[model samples]
Target chain A: MRNMIVASTSTLYGGGYLEYLTPFLSKRLKAASIKELLFIPFARPGGISHDDYTSKVRAVFQTMHVNVKGIHEFEDPIKAIQDAQGIFTGGGNTFQLIKMLHDLQLVEPLRKVIYQGVFYLGTSAGSNICGLNIRTTNDMPVVQPSSFKATGALAYNINPHYQDPIEGDQHMGETREQRINEFHIYNHIPVIGLREGSFIDVQGTTEILKGTLKARLFQAGKAPMEIEPETDFATLNLNH
Target chain B: MRNMIVASTSTLYGGGYLEYLTPFLSKRLKAASIKELLFIPFARPGGISHDDYTSKVRAVFQTMHVNVKGIHEFEDPIKAIQDAQGIFTGGGNTFQLIKMLHDLQLVEPLRKVIYQGVFYLGTSAGSNICGLNIRTTNDMPVVQPSSFKATGALAYNINPHYQDPIEGDQHMGETREQRINEFHIYNHIPVIGLREGSFIDVQGTTEILKGTLKARLFQAGKAPMEIEPETDFATLNLNH
Candidate 1:
């Protein structure tokens, strides 16, 4: 079975990094019998180095009795993913992550291992790759990737850290909703706007919403609506 | 003379399209003795069609006694830029605009004409092209251009619709400043954050801030600071 926890963010405001996710992680990691994970730190939030980011993630997973290893630690990244008991892609700039993935020629190999039922955890930019493409990401294009194509881990796309337009807001920049509407003009993939603390719990062909908050769903030629917690996203007809 | 008005936005809040720019347009269009201008509506704001978007801009330019013709109306787009007495690129999605520019093989041609002393008016996405690239745009990657490369009419980049972090805001999405800072991690190009109504008035090599507001300037490894209105941007030492 495909077991995954694609979260919107690694940290919640006013909470320690991955603190809010402890309960879920403990249960999921134990269920999968995964005591170690291969971490992809290529996203490099705030330009953090791979070793430093790996250490940071190590500190958190250590609290859960899980060992974490950065992919950069291995001489061959493809081999690292193949040998890992589980995989976790952390949050950061999506462009940077995808660029490094493509540069290392790791996209196909990583996708292959994930489908073989290796446990996977993705937060923020990590969650974005679980979708069809990174086109819907809220992050800036600080770096250009080989393509916007992301891992087809899920049938639809993900817009993490999704925000609603503020009432009486005057900023003329297109709001997240308007941007998604424009995406529909050229694409048909449904997009899930996962608010902070929200995530999709994926197992095999089933994907369910978690973290209590209602998630917003946007598909081409249709009005956006809220998907309550525990709703199966597959029922949204997110198929291409 | 590289006469140009690279504006932050096409319309100010609570104002009609291009209404707030009439005073500047009246003087500039008259000074150039230009009665007709070529419009590139490829940006296609709100997914607006070239014909409809052209009509909207034409109505505004008519009020200034200048006729507006969309590049789409021409069988030969490169020739349109070469033959035009002046040029105006309306505001819209920067990715959409630049993608179309590259797709039509118009970047170098437009750049050549602009440097050849053709008066140019660029609002929002239009203004962004005058910069080095579209890395700093606030628009989503609703579309991916062949490349992020822009016309380099200016030494730096432009972050149109620049916004500051709201006090007491709890959203964890990176602020405008933070995003630019991350950009500096991989890029050294200085970026000008043009607030609504702010613009750069370029004459030959002289680029001065206009629209009665202080613009924010971000440079690699330097603290962001405000540039007062009437200040020339060249003094910012924006060399790559």
Candidate 2:
């Protein structure tokens, strides 16, 4: 069995950090019977320190009466994951997060625990790791990971914080759609473009698209399709 | 002597591919006594085939009476670079271009030829490879190269297609500036955010910022500075 909430971003437009997610998150945590949550702040957004980033998350979870601790504080992080009732991976730089995950050799262990039914939550870069690989991440390559392989908790790759092309914008950088199209040229993996405020709620084999925004689904050699909210992601053939 | 024209993009606003660059390109080629240009089409913009992409560039250069040949057409790409009088590496995907360069072991040969004053021109992804590493590139990681290590023809990295933050836009994706800042957190290599229409012209040790736009200079632990057009980039201490 698998249980996870993979969100496109920690904060939605005009909302505070974790504010928009709290209601949905509380419901998930409550159903999972998780009180204490272990936080992985390895992504280190804006280069924030581990303790500082952890405190930010702690402050948010505190409102729900949940105890939060960063994984870095633990002497044995592997044991921390093994013992945790719930886990949250905050967003930041995907390269750094995957680099640390590989360097600590925690990918397999984390994958095993999550597949065995541990409660897990991931946002942005955190959500990216839940995919088969980190190839579709939108973050800068601040550092190099040992391997692009990720947790693979989900069958497809996740393109978190996916944005539609801005109308009338003169900037020549490839649009998000163009970039994903190029990705298909080299890879056949199905990619789910999770816009901000959108998420995938996976329980057992049922993965539903949660949140109000629509998600864009891209497959190799096929036109991109818009996936509506409340759509069951499992219904789609994601495994290529 | 080293002679190179590294540009932020191949196309400018409302212009055909290489249209804005043709005037400058023709002058440079004439000065270098070049009749034919060798093209590297591995980047393959929009997933165009190498022959098709090469043909596009060939058609453009043909207007100036300069014959063009793709390196892929040669059985010995290494020898083609060694013998070419002028070389042009067009833009597309940085990862794909660097991957091909590494796979064919052409990085060192290309560097040697450019250093030997072969009159090289690079746009977008092509310009990115002239740096110390591809770490600062704005392109998506559609594919991973064996190493981030690039040609190192330039001491610093290039952030091609650099754009400033959009005013009043609510998109949460990190702006190009913020992305570069994140890059500085893990890297000490200096980055030149070459805006569209801007380029760096390198002759021997002197590198000048050309075109009508200003470039942004980014270094670790320092605020990004706006570099004016016509500024001699070589005067700046970019090694830090």
Candidate 3:
């Protein structure tokens, strides 16, 4: 089956962008395993141009002189994705990313690419779309949607950069945990609270956590559990 | 004129259980000369019975020997609200509060009470429904509704407990401001980021800021502004 490596952030710079799959990306690229990198730039900040937003990936690929293309430029993106060697979706607004994907009917094709084991890598919004719904998202409902459904890549939703409630403040706002719990009241999907500098590496069905802190797993009506790196997440039995 | 005070917290205790409403609710209740406090227990935590929730509120009121009534038992809540000396809404799940209000057709009646100068008080979810839409709420979209509209009590939306993004996290989640900004793009309503310990005191035609920090205002296609507590919120034209 096609493998998916979903990260909270890109691990290129000192930025603790959830340093997952750096070794994998490097090894895969060095061995000439993938002929090209198809960059999905829909999550670009403020929906900027693909060239401007995908520059970081382009720069990284330039070091290896690997072929790269931003699928946003294509008039027929579904076919473009179908013909791609591998896919990497950068982070930005998940709502915008999903909006564009649904608008262009690329969700199914992208899903097919992942299921085909065509080397799929996702960051932030990219990672969020891999889940059942954007309910775990820290993003605001900036736009209305036909639905909150996503790719259903995982049984649990993803809350990237999950932070506990601040210790001392008078704000009456609900904490991230509280918000996610509310999401559970109406949703059966479990949630994965991925902090900064953490990620999930899925190689053929095996998910390896990579980061300093353990990821928090939240199932409906159950207390969250912290899982360290090397923990096999697939065995969580999140479906129950 | 109906005096509406959307508090940040309850004033029953030392105000530590809830911390945001010191100035807003405390000052308004004092000014309204409200010795009697009628509590609305529909948003009780743990889904407690209306009688149980009401008894707890009455118990709390007994300490001060202040008259307290649970509006949940009233067949004509609107009439009860119209005749009440003061109505105080404690906070819980905003979805629950909204659902009950809509089911009971009390939104407009509550609005009417506020207009009648009944000295209305609310915290968290209670204050959230006071806006035109709960889009600015910190609550998760636990369930979808036919619409995202609310009471339209204020000219703008309220994002209580606004916090700045962490300085050093590689997590790719959107910040609180970014989320509300997204809401602005999809909806035209102005959003006010009311930090903890901050609130607006609505007395008759005057809505004054009564808190320690400046409230962040977000509008579509415009830069957000942080208005201080002393700013004349009533005079600010938000017609656009």
| Candidate number achieving the greatest DockQ relative to the actual structure | 2
lDDT of 2 by residue, A156-198 (tens): 9999999999889888889999999999999999999999989
Query: Relative to the true structure, how large is the alpha-carbon lDDT of every model?
Result: 0.90, 0.92, 0.72
Worst 10 residues of 1 chain B by lDDT: B231-240
lDDT of 3 by residue, A66-132 (tens): 6778897777899999998888888876767787888888888888777877777888788898887
lDDT per residue for candidate 1 within B65-146, as digits (tens), equals 9999999999999999999999999988888999999999999999999898999999999988998888888878888789
* Predicted complex 3: DockQ: 0.34
TM-score for chain B of each model, two decimals? 0.98, 0.98, 0.86
Tens-place lDDT digits, model 3, residues B37-147: 778876654445678877866765554445788887777887787788888777766656676777777788887778777887777677887888776766665554444
Q: Model 1's CAPRI class?
A: medium
Task: List candidate 3 stretches off by more than 4 Å.
Answer: A11-21, A29-32, A46-51, A64-68, A103-105, A164-172, B9-14, B17-89, B93-119, B164-174, B178-188, B219-224
DockQ of each: 0.77, 0.80, 0.34
Q: Which window of ten consecutive residues has the lowest lDDT sum in model 2 chain B?
A: B231-240
Q: Give me the overall lDDT of model 1.
A: 0.90
How well does candidate 2 score on lDDT at residue B199? 89
Q: Higher-lDDT candidate among 2 and 3?
A: 2
Colliding residue pairs in candidate 2: none
Q: Name every residue pair that clashes in candidate 1.
A: none
Best by lDDT: 2
Q: Which order, best to worst by lDDT?
A: 2, 1, 3
